[model samples]
Target: MQYFPVFLNAQNLDCLVVGAGEVAARKVELLAKTPATIRVVAPQACQTIQAMAEQGLLKWIQREFDPGDIQGQQLIFVATDNHQLNCDISTLAKAANIPVNVVDNTELCSFITPSIVDRDPLLVALSSSGTAPVLLRYLRQKLESILPARLSELAKFSDKFRDKVKAHFNNVNQRRHFWEDVIEGDIAETVLAGDNQQAEQLIEQKLQQDEQTEAGCVYLVGAGPGDPDLLTFKALRLMQKADLVVYDRLVSKPILELVRRDAEKIYVGKKASLHSVPQNEINQLLVDAAKQGKRVVRLKGGDPYIFGRGGEEAETLVEQGISFQVVPGITAATGASTYAGIPLTHRDHAQSVVFSTGHLKDGSIDLDWPALARQRQTMVFYMGLTGLNVISQQLIKHGVAADMPVAVVQSATTDKQQVVTGTLMDIQQKASEANIQPPALIIVGTVVSLREKIG
Candidate 1:
């Protein structure tokens, strides 16, 4: 480490800036974000600095560098075109045992400001210690996206109850465990989700309890077709905290790899005519794991409610009275269709869209053929590859054209994705010729014809 990182207390801090041009203005703006008393001395001030001073943001001593400026200042920033003047200010501040930062000059400085991400009471400071500034900024942008905006509120909420919680627990270890449960449990989640009232109630209820229950919650997260990038922030967060992950076959390998490193995983995905793990067994697994105080993630491919039997699992959770949260993911049809350059509904080609499962239940794909055969409407079928011949014959028999444009998209949104476009009469043959795999989507409509144009 080139420099040790410290979050200096800004309350009642005395800050001094020896220059007032653009570079100095940037430093002033950062200091202004805190409750610091600022004094800037410069011969000529930029418009930004002048505006800040006019608005009572800081005290501007409109004069050249003065040794008096360093007096009583706890922190000093030297940002001047004159190298000698910056060096002189740095020497004065360092000799007085005050921290000084000479912008762009590391050797003359006592400390350097880092790229800061401010979330009120919660702040993230990242630095390369004046080296690799651009890389530091890039890292800052990444952190901004991953960090929640309301994290400050969550931190404040915890702070408000710290003393009360400490008093409630006689042992320090017990208090530490309580805080762990609060921050990692639903209380912190509800707070971050913007339900502070509910969080407060939960916290109060927890305090009144004689003992904390070992019952853990379940998260039904959609893996979003096959793309790892398509996972939601909530989904990612829950996945990382998972003590156990129950995933499906359709969930891509890349997406599956994102689950918590130490989390236990079980594959309950079904193959055609084969049940790897029965649906009822899978439901029971979730309830049992959660009852054992395991943070369980029931990871599903695509939208779970959409043919993924997510409703079945949710009903089971409800029946068992297990606390759970559902994080939605992009369904296969929409994701696959778009990546194949086949819009589900277009102004001229498709007026409406219908989603159906071609997987036969009891021996036949029992869909309303007449409604599905409507013109100018796009038809998407999940698990349709096996019943492609039946689907084609049924649609054609139900007044649909045999030459209706069709597309079969396999592994949608992934590097291995493949799209086979042909007429309904010939798509099955084309798909077979290319050896298109399962976990594919069938998009049927004139929109499939636009693949050549838009794709």
Candidate 2:
């Protein structure tokens, strides 16, 4: 959190750049795309800067550095060859309460230029507090490769429908839900495919569906591992139809962004310290939201049934006699193993796969030692962070070999993913060294040895 990010409207503003070298030329070029009055002050102007000045597009001040030159500017850039001059401009600009960038001199500047991803109406600013611009630029390049060129058009398309959605859905909450439907709906898919006609048609159909599905219903959607790309078609379809999305903390942010921007997002995520919404209350909230005829999506991170407590949620929905659907996603065990390059059940190593929770019914590590101690079986433990040591010690105590291979995968299937492998006797130490935290999956057994084979 080195630098606070803020978007500035440069249109019709006074912008000043001091220096006319290559660095200053770049700053001027970036500013030229915006509707701003740009003035450059430098002893020698580059060919591009001079050309702009001759065309009446810019004012060139061919002179030495003057402190008063930046006085009337709203935004200023000091890209001079002289470090002292850049420092002076920065100090003067700060005193005048104007934002200034001293090229590469971060310490002398009040403002630092961020690595920007411009998708016209959609801008993503990445900054490492000016300390790691190269790394930030690398990340920006990666993001640019992944982001579609049609994002601006899609954003404009949604904006066009904003008024119509509000006019049709009188209630604020219902309207918000409708927009979420729009984003997850066929409209987004069609727009992304460059089919405006189909997109509009999908929007119309969504409105009709919204009217028809007036009776509240709930969809228990598993988001699938950490990748939004891994979400099931049914899960995505339901998300597109949601009026309100109540999601857990482990669900990835990029996946959450896929939900409608206007939709009411309620985070009922429970982490170790933060409990915004408790389980029982969350269940009741869903029931109440569904009763109001609003489409509610309970977005979980992994398969609803696999250590997700989805069974409990289903029971609540059934008892309430509420219309509900379950959308299965890739469970943590399966997803982690797949991406970590470890097969949960290798034919040569493991005969069967067993999924177990390290945290027991009493909120303690109470695994069946004999069952887990057996060799030649793949063991996937979910929510094992709190009980890793105990689980490890018990298995060894129950005749399991201390050298049994184990792999701890944190945030599997995500860009921040890390796989740390060791034996039961040393896996915890490996995890500690790697700083492996929850929102993780643990694989224990001889099958973990398959990493060597796969690699």
Candidate 3:
């Protein structure tokens, strides 16, 4: 570690800032977030700094920064444009036994500010010891996407019950176990979901229960189409907390990487010609894992409820009495269509959207041809690549126009995404020529034509 990381309490502490430019203004803004008594001394002040001074947020001494300004201050910030003056300020602060930060000059900095993800009570800071500020900021942005905005709410809520929990579970290990379960289980989920009353009630109930025993639960999380960015904050949180992850083929590799590293990952992915693990076996595996007092995650791609067999898994969990929560994701139909620039519904084209699975249990392309053949409606078929020829022939034979536009989007929303477009009369041939693969979406409607205009 280049620098020992520490968080200082800024409340009611006198802090001195030497400058009034953009950098100093930004420093003041950060300090203002705390209850620090800030004093800025410079030859001139920016409009924002002057406004803050007039509003009594800070004291602005309109004069050149001198060694006297560093007196009686707990911390110092040197943000002046002049390099020599900044160095002089840093020297004075160090001489006075005060910690000082020289902006943009890491060599002179007694302390450096980190890129902070401020979820209030749950703050995450990233620092490169001033060697790579941009990299720190990039990492902060990644964390911002994964961490829930309302995570602080859970922290605040738990604070109210800390004493009660501490009193109830006197044993250190028991208390630690209890808190772990509470934070990784439904209590935290309820609080994160904005149900404070339910969360508090659940917390009380747990506290009243035997702290020696811990119950296990499962989360049915949608990993989204292909992009890990599409995964919900709740999904990411549960993924990291899971003790075991049961995933499928549709779940992207990038999405699976987000799961906790220590967690056991079992692949039950099913391909068109392969079933590595049967559906019943996968369901039983989740139940068995939870029975072992483990937090299990049955992660699926796309919206779990949307033909992802999540309903079946959820039903099995219910019968087995395993507690679980479902986190939705961006399904292929919406994700593929948008990325391919084909609107699923439009006033000038499609009025209604229909989603169907092209693959059937008994290996047959059985669908309501007449209903799907209707105009002014968009149809999206999942797992339909293998049955594209049948789908095209059936639709065209069932009173649908032979020239109806169709599009096949493969690996939708991913870098490998490929789109093949043609009329119903020749879509199968076009898809074959493009060599479109599985995990693709098939769109059949006039909306397919819009891809040319808007794509």
Residue 399 local lDDT, model 3: 82
Q: Report clash pairs, candidate 2.
A: 177-243, 216-293
lDDT of 3 by residue, 1-455 (tens): 88988999887799999999888999999898899999999989999899999999999999997787777999999998899988888888888789999999999988899889999977887889988878888899899999988999988997899898888866544565578788889999999899999999998887777555456788999888999998999999889878889999988888988998878899999987679998999999999988877788889999999999999999999999999888898999999999999989999998999999899888899899899888898999999899999999999898889899999999999889999999988999989998888888899999999999998
User: 250-284, model 2: which lDDT tens digit per residue?
Assistant: 89998898886666899988865456887899999
Q: Weakest 10 consecutive residues, lDDT, candidate 3?
A: 169-178
By TM-score, who's the top model here?
2
Order of models, best TM-score first: 2, 3, 1
Model 1 scores what on Cα lDDT?
0.90
Instruction: Give each model's whole-structure lDDT.
Output: 0.90, 0.85, 0.89
What lDDT tens digits, residue by residue, belong to model 1 across residues 75-178? 99999999988888888888999999999999999998889898988889988978799999999999999999999999999999999998887755356558
Ranking of candidates on lDDT, top first: 1, 3, 2
Q: List the residue pairs that clash in candidate 3.
A: none
Q: Model 1 clash pairs?
A: none
